[model samples]
Target chain A: MSINKLAYYPGCPSDGTAVDQDMSTKAVFEKLGVELVEVEDWNCCGAAEVEDPKVVYALNARNLAIAEKEDLDIVTPCSICYYNLERSNKALKADEALCTKLKGIDSSLDYGGKIKTKHVLDVFVNDIGMDEISSKLEKKVNVKVAPYYGCYIGRPPETAFDDPDNPVLMDKLIELIGGEIVPNFNYMKTVCCGGPLMMTRGDIAFDMARKILDVAKNAGADCISLACPLCGMMLDGKQADIEKALGITIGMPVVYITQLLGLALGIEPNKLGLNKNAVDTKEILGKVV
Target chain B: MPIKTWELDPNFKNEIMGEAGGERLASCFQCSTCTLGCPITEIVPSYNPRKIIQMSLLGMRKEVLSNPDLWVCLICQTCTARCPQDVRIADVLSAIRRIAEREEEAGNLKIDSPRPLFDKAFQHQLEKYGRLYDIGLAKEYYPKKEGSFIKGMKAMMKDYKDFGMRMFKKGKMGPKAMLAPKVKGRAVIKKIFKEMGEE
Candidate 1:
C-alpha cells in the first residue's frame, strides 16, 4: 500500500556528517511504500549556536518558506533540524513584529507558516502506524536495543513531537521490529549527549556520551538504537574516541533506528549503509537470525 | 578565610528581565529543581543552574556575565521542561552569554576561552558561504584564537589527525565537497544575515 509523499528535509547531516542516516531513511521509507520528495534547493539549518535568536529564526524560516511553497508536511530524520524548524515556526507565531521584520528581510521568500514539521520517528509511529510497520517486517531482529531518544524529540512542552518525560514511540517501534527494549531504565528516555558542544569540549562530551554508553552496557543491550543523527554521530562516530578517553572498550555498535528497521524489513545491510558505521556491525549482524 | 559582602545590584535582575526571553525571571521561586535536573551539574558541581538563577536575581552581574559556565549549557531545555515556574533557565543563560559578548566587545570583560571565538567563527562562516565549512572555519578561527600562528597550525593539524582522517575516509569530508561544492541561493541567505546585522 502506497502512502502519501512527504517533503523530506534531508538536513545538512544527510550530505555530510551522517550520510548513512540519509541512505537508510530513504531505503526504509521506500520499502515501506512512502515516497520522500526532497525539498528543492534547501539550505543548511545552522546547527551551531548563534548569538542572536533572530539568526536561527531566519535560518530555519527560510527552509519552512521553501517547503510551504511546495505544500507538504516536512519530515526530517535529524532531531536538531526538526527542533529548529519547529522553534522558528513557533517564534514567528509568538511575535508578529519579529515575524514581519523577518519577512521583510528577504523580499523573494515568503514565511507563510504553512507546513508542519514532523520527526521521522513520529511519522513512523503516528502516520505509518505500528500495524502496517509490523506486518511488513520480513524477519525477527532479536537483538537487545537500548532505545536512546536523546533530549530533542520531546521536551519544551509547547513544541514536542512526543511525551517529554517518558517517550514510548521508539520503544513501540523497537518491539514491532522484534527487538527487545532494555527494561525499566528511566534514564534511557531523556539523557543529553553533549551535541554540537562536543566540537569544542571533548572532555565534557566524552563524559556525557560515556554515561549513556555505560547505562546501555550495564543493561546488557547488544546495541544502541537512536533516532537523531547528532546522537548517531556521538554514539557511532565518536564511540572509539569515547573508549580511548575513558580507557574502556565498549564493543556495542550504535546503529540508527531506521537502519535496524530496514534490517528487520530484510533490506540488504550494505544498502542501509551499515558498513559506514564507525563501530563495525558485522559481528552483531552475524548473531542476528 | 575572610568574609565577603556582595554589594547587591538590585537593578541586575530587572535588567535581565528587560532582555528578550528573560521576562520570566521574576517567576523563579528558588526551587532547586532546575539544578537537580541539570546533567552538567552532575559532572561540574560548581556550575549550578538554581544557584545561578538565585545569583542573577540577587544582582550578581559581574559574576554572571564573566563566568565560563554561562556558555557551558547545552540549551537542551531539560531545565526548562522541569521548571515548575516556567523560568526558561536555558534562555536566561543564553541572554547572559549575549551580554557577555557585548561586554567583551567593549573591552569591559576579558574572556580566556575558546567558545566565544569558535562561535564568532561559526557565524562568520555562515555569513560568507551560507554553511559551515570545517576547513574554512579552522583557517579563519585558529590564528587569532591561539594568539600565535605556529600553535594554531599545530592545534589544527592535531585535530585533523584525530578525527579529520576518519571523517575524510567516511566521505563526510573531502577535497571536492568540503572545498567548494555548489551552494544554493547563497545571495538570499547572505542578504538575510546582512539585514539582521549579523554580517
Candidate 2:
C-alpha cells in the first residue's frame, strides 16, 4: 500500500544531535507529497537502556496511544525508537494484563496496538515503492555507497520487515538514486556499530565502528548511507574520535538515507542539513552535483 | 573459576523466567550461538554470553548478579536474533541485569560500569521533560559520583571536550540547541512513571 501520510515520531535525539536527519526526512517526504503529522505530545520511547520491561512498555505505549488517536501508521527514523515502539506494540497486543495496567496509568493512554510502527527506510522502500522513488530522483549520484543497516532495524527477526541477516532495502534505495553499492558489504552491513555502549564503553564502541569503517574503506566506497541517527552519530559524528583513539585514518563520510534521497530529489543541501554532518560531504557532493 | 555445586541457587533460573523478556530462559540448551554472534565477546573476550548463561543455569545467583561483565553486553540483540533455542539471549541478559540492578539498590552488590548511572540520568530526563534534554542529561549524569563538583566537572569536560567542540563547530550543539523545548506531556510522563512504580 502506498501511504500518503504518517504519524511522525521524531524521537528525542532528532531535536538535537540528529537535527539533520529530521530535516532531511521531512524534506524527502514533502518532496514525495507525503504529509507527516507529528504525533501529539509524544514522549521518549524508553530507549534500549531501560531494562524494566514495564517502564519500556509504559513509555512506548503512551506514544503509541497518541499515534493511534491520529489513526495512522507511525514512522520514525531512529532504529532504536522503531524497535522499542514496535516491540512494545506487539507485546501490548499479546498481553492483555499489561494493556490493562497501562490503561490504569491514563484512560486515554490505552493503546489498541493497532498502528504499525515503521522505520522511515521501510516506508521509503515498501510503502513508497522503488519505482516511485527512482522516478523522483533528479540527479544521478556517481559514488560507491556502502549501505549500513546497523542492528535494530533488522534484528530480533520477528519485527523486521526486511531480511534480518542480509537487508537490502537501503541498498535498493541507494541504487534507486544511481549510487553504486560497495562490494562485500553484506557481511559487515548488519554488524553492530556498538551504539548503545558508545557513551559508557567508548573503547569497544569505537573499535566496532572502526571495523565497519575499515570494511567500507577497503571496499573502495566513497561514502556510507544509513538510516539510524545513532549509527550516524557514531560512524560520522565520532569518526574523528575513532581515528584518534585507534591512530588510523578513516575519512568515510556518513550520510543519512534521507539526506542522500533528498539530494537526488533536487532538495537544497542546506535543506538536507548536509553541512551539519561532522565528516565533510564535499567530496561526495562534488561528484553528485 | 571452579563451580561449587552447593553454592548454586537452582531457583535462580526460575527467578529469571519470572521477569519480563525472560519467559524463555529455561529453553536455552547452551548451543553457543549467542556467544558466537556477540560483537562484545569479540572485543572483550572475557565478556561471554554463553558463560553467563551457563553460570545462571548452574545456580550462581550471587556471582551472576554481581558480575561487572553483565553491563558490557550492549543489549544489541544480535544474540537474541541468532539463538537456536529461541532463548532471546539479549532479553535474558536484560532480565539478569534487572536483577543485578535490584541487588545493587538493596546494597547487596555493586555495579562497576557507569552504564546504570547513565541509564538513571536518561530516565530522569524522560520524567522531567517528557523527552531527553541533552544539556540537562549531561548536568545530571556528571557530578553524580562520590566526589566534589569540580572533579566531576573536570571529568565531564575531559571526556567530551574534543567531541563537543566538533559538534559545536558543525552547528549540531549550541545555545539555540540548548534551548530546545521539551515535550508538553510532562504530566503524562510523570503518571506513566508512577503507574509503573518507577517514580
Candidate 3:
C-alpha cells in the first residue's frame, strides 16, 4: 500500500496558526518520496462548531467533490477536517437525499462519493509503512514525547482509521523515529483539548489544557506531539496562558507530529517551522539536532 | 421544581428525531454512560448530557433549547464513541443547538453564548472567500455594540493582545496573512451556501 501522491486539504488553520504543520507535513512527505498535491480550490469543512447539518454536509461535500475530480484519495493533517470530511463523505454516500440536495447546490459539482478521505497520520502509518518511514530517518529522536491524540482523530469509531480509545499509529510512528513515548500518556491521549469551547469558555478550556500538560510534565515528557491544529492551538498556543492563569509554570513545548517527524528525517529546523511554536521548542530540538 | 405536565411538548423528542443528526435520539435509555464519559461535565457539573436527553425526551423544549449549557460541549464525541445505545450524544446536542439557533433567529429566545456568532462569522468567511481569513473572522466575531466600533475594537485588541502578538511574531497572523489568496471557486462556495439556505 505505497502511496506516491495524495490530494492534500490544508484546512483553514494550516494557513494561519498551524502553518508549521502545513510546512512540516509537506517536508516530511516529500522526503519520504510521497507527493502531496493541494486539493484545488477547497473550502472550509465547518470544523466542529457548525451545528447545522445542512451547512456541514454542503461544505464538506464541496471539498470532497473537488477531491473526486483529482482522482485521488484526500488526506488532511487536521483531525477536525479529517473527521468532518470523512463523515460527510460517508453520509453523502449512504444518504441519497443528501447527494440530491448537494447536486441542487451546484449541478456542475458532482461527487460520486468515490474518494476515501484519510488523515495524514493514517497515510504515514498504514500506507507509507513504518519500515519505509524508518529507512528515511537520518536522525533518531532521543527526546521523550507524549503522543497526544486529541478528539476528532479517534472518535465516533466509524470514520476513524485507528482505535478510537487507544490509537497507536502515532505511538508507533514516534517510536520508529527513535522518540521515546511517555509512560503515562495513554490516559490523556484521547482527552478533549477543549478547543471548540476556547472562545466562549476560556476558563474550562484552559483548565482542560492544564490537566493534559500537567500529566505530560509529570510523566517526564520532553515535549508533547500532536496532530490536530485546534489541539495545537490549545496545547501549544495557550500553554503560557494556562500557566499564568493557573499560577503554574508548565513551560512544556508542544510540537506537531509532522514537525517531530521532519526533524527525525533530518529536515532543517526552519523547514519544519520549529521556531513558529509559541512554546519554545529549542530545548527538545537541541536534544535531537 | 414541580412537574408541569401542561408546559411539556410531547412532540419535542420527535422534532429532534426529525433533524439530521438526531435520528437516534429516541434510543437513549437513561443509562447515564454519555454523562459519565463527558469531560465538560467533569468541569461544569451542571452541564449534563443525560439530563439534556431526558429533558428533550420529556418535551421540555424551551428549557432544553434555551439552556446556555447547550454550547458548552466541546463536541469531542467521547460520549458518542462510548454510548452503548449509540445515541451519538454530541451530534444530538448539535441537532438541539440548530433548533436553538433558529429559535434565537426568530426572536423567540436568547442564547447567552457568542458561539453562534463565531459560527456565523466562520461560515461567512467560507462563503465569501472559500477559506478562513483570520483577521476577517476576528472583525466579524467581536461584538459591534451599537455604534462604538472603536471601543469594541479596543476591547478585542486587549483580549487578544498577547496571543495575537505571538502569532504576529511567528508571521502566522498580520496584514500580510489577511491578504492571503482566496480559493479560485468562491462562486461555487457561495452557490453551495445559498442552495443550503445558509446564506
DockQ for each candidate? Answer: 0.56, 0.73, 0.69
- lDDT tens digits, residue span A183-215, model 3: 977989999999888876889999899999999
Segments in model 1 whose C-alpha atoms lie over 4 Å from true places: A1-3, B1-8, B174-177, B197-199
Q: Local error of candidate 3 at A187, Å?
A: 1.1
Relative to the unseen true structure, what is the C-alpha lDDT of residue B47 in candidate 1, on a scale of 0 to 100? 82
CA error at residue A64 for candidate 2, angstroms: 1.2
**Second chain alone, TM-score for each candidate:** 0.87, 0.92, 0.92
**Model 2 stretches with alpha carbons more than 4 Å out:** B197-199
- Which residue pairs show collisions in model 2? B9-B59
Please rank every candidate by TM-score, starting with the best: 2, 3, 1
What residue pairs are clashing in model 3?
none
User: What ranking emerges by DockQ with the best candidate at the front?
Assistant: 2, 3, 1
Residues A5-46 of candidate 2 have per-residue lDDT tens digits of 999999877876788999999999999989999998888888
In candidate 1, what are the lDDT values of residues A203-288, reduced to their tens digit?
88889888888888899888898888888888888787788878999977888999999988889998888888877888657655
Q: Against the unseen true structure, what C-alpha lDDT does each candidate score?
A: 0.80, 0.86, 0.86
